[model samples]
Target: MMKTMKILTALAATMATIPAVAHEIWVERDASGPARIYLGEPAEAVPEAGDPEFHHLQKPQAIQSDDKPIAFVRRANHIEATVPGSGDVRVRDDSVFAPWKSGEKMQGAIFYARAGRSETAAKLDLELVPAAANADRFTLLFRGKPVPAAKLTVITPDRWQKAFFTDANGGVEIPKLGAGRYIVGASHTEEGPAKLGGQDVASVVHISTLTFVR
Candidate 1:
């Protein structure tokens, strides 16, 4: 209980230091193969104004559904990979963006992304886990505890978007979710004195997304 309070306090101190809404990273995948990870807004798909250069994606991991580690292939506009298993395939890049100046302090960010809504355990520091297999309702967690009243943004496959807030228990439900890929994003910032690329930083940010097709 004390640890959760400390984390929540640290988050409150740093959330305003950096704006979490910006070009985000997300993943789209099929059940057995072909996962394309993007470094920009999904509304444009790719090669659009909001999309950054695909090369900006750093060493992101393809957390598989099974015990075996799947391989990734880098392409010109996106990272391509053949993923195994029928469950959710998660991806993350701790160094997607290099440490940069946020006014006078150096700030760093870590992006966490998922490509399915199947029943999957939390693997990243921040994740949007489905309530059940292929469920639309989700729970937001920080260090494995509910994060009350956090903002969660949902982008439907048709490019419609709406932001929802988590309840006291960090739970939210996606309304009228339909076919195609959906991207759900949330972020958290921690007051930090941490190292990135051998450089120290004042705060570290975490942005997470859950993308799944109905």
Candidate 2:
């Protein structure tokens, strides 16, 4: 467990830093081919924005499913790799953006992403997972425990978004918006000594997203 947590910064902790960049990282794979990791908003495109952030992905080629390594390559705007199985594919990047000032304190940010939903186990230190198979219910957990009252943003396939807070169980249910890709974005803040781009930070913000087709 200690070894896994070490690699986490090094994916995040508490309220994340997403205001400045407004960019997010996620993975996508249809019946067409390999899973592709992306850095941007779900329903919108930042136009060549992903390539620049691609360099910040320093973690080894990885996917939580099966605990095996996969080779990811930089494409025109995203990272692509062939995953091993149908299980969820998770990705984390700690150095994507430089730490920025958030109010009185300077904060660093870490981003975690999952390509598939419905996988119940918590692969990342923090994540949003389906509470049950064949249901729209979901839960936000940190290290396998509920992250209660956290703010959650749901982005629909049509570039629409709605924001709300989680219930006591760290759970929320979103009515199926449509027949396209959907992304649920949530963040938490952890205070401690951390580094962003090799610089010291007062606290680290973790931004996690769950992407899946409805």
Tell me the whole-model lDDT of each prediction, alpha carbons only. 0.80, 0.77
Q: Encode model 1's per-residue lDDT on 1-214: one tens digit a residue.
A: 9999999998887765543348788888777778888888666657743354455686887665467766678776778777766667778787776777786899898888888776657987899988988887899988898888999888987889999999999999998767887889999888969987677999888899988888
The deviation in Å at residue 205 for candidate 2 is 0.7
Model 1 segments more than 4 A misplaced: 1-21, 48-50, 64-69
RMSD of each: 9.7, 10.1
lDDT of 2 at 139: 88
- Per-residue CA lDDT of candidate 2, range 1-214, in tens? 9999887855453334434456778777775468888876666764675644555555524545465667777777777887776767788878778787666777888888986776777878789888776368888998788999999888888879999788999999987888988888899999987878888889988989888887
Provide the TM-score for each candidate, comma-separated.
0.83, 0.81
**In model 2, which range of ten residues has the least summed lDDT?**
11-20
Off by over 4 Å in 2: 1-19, 46-61, 65-67
lDDT (Cα, 0-100) at 74 in candidate 1: 74
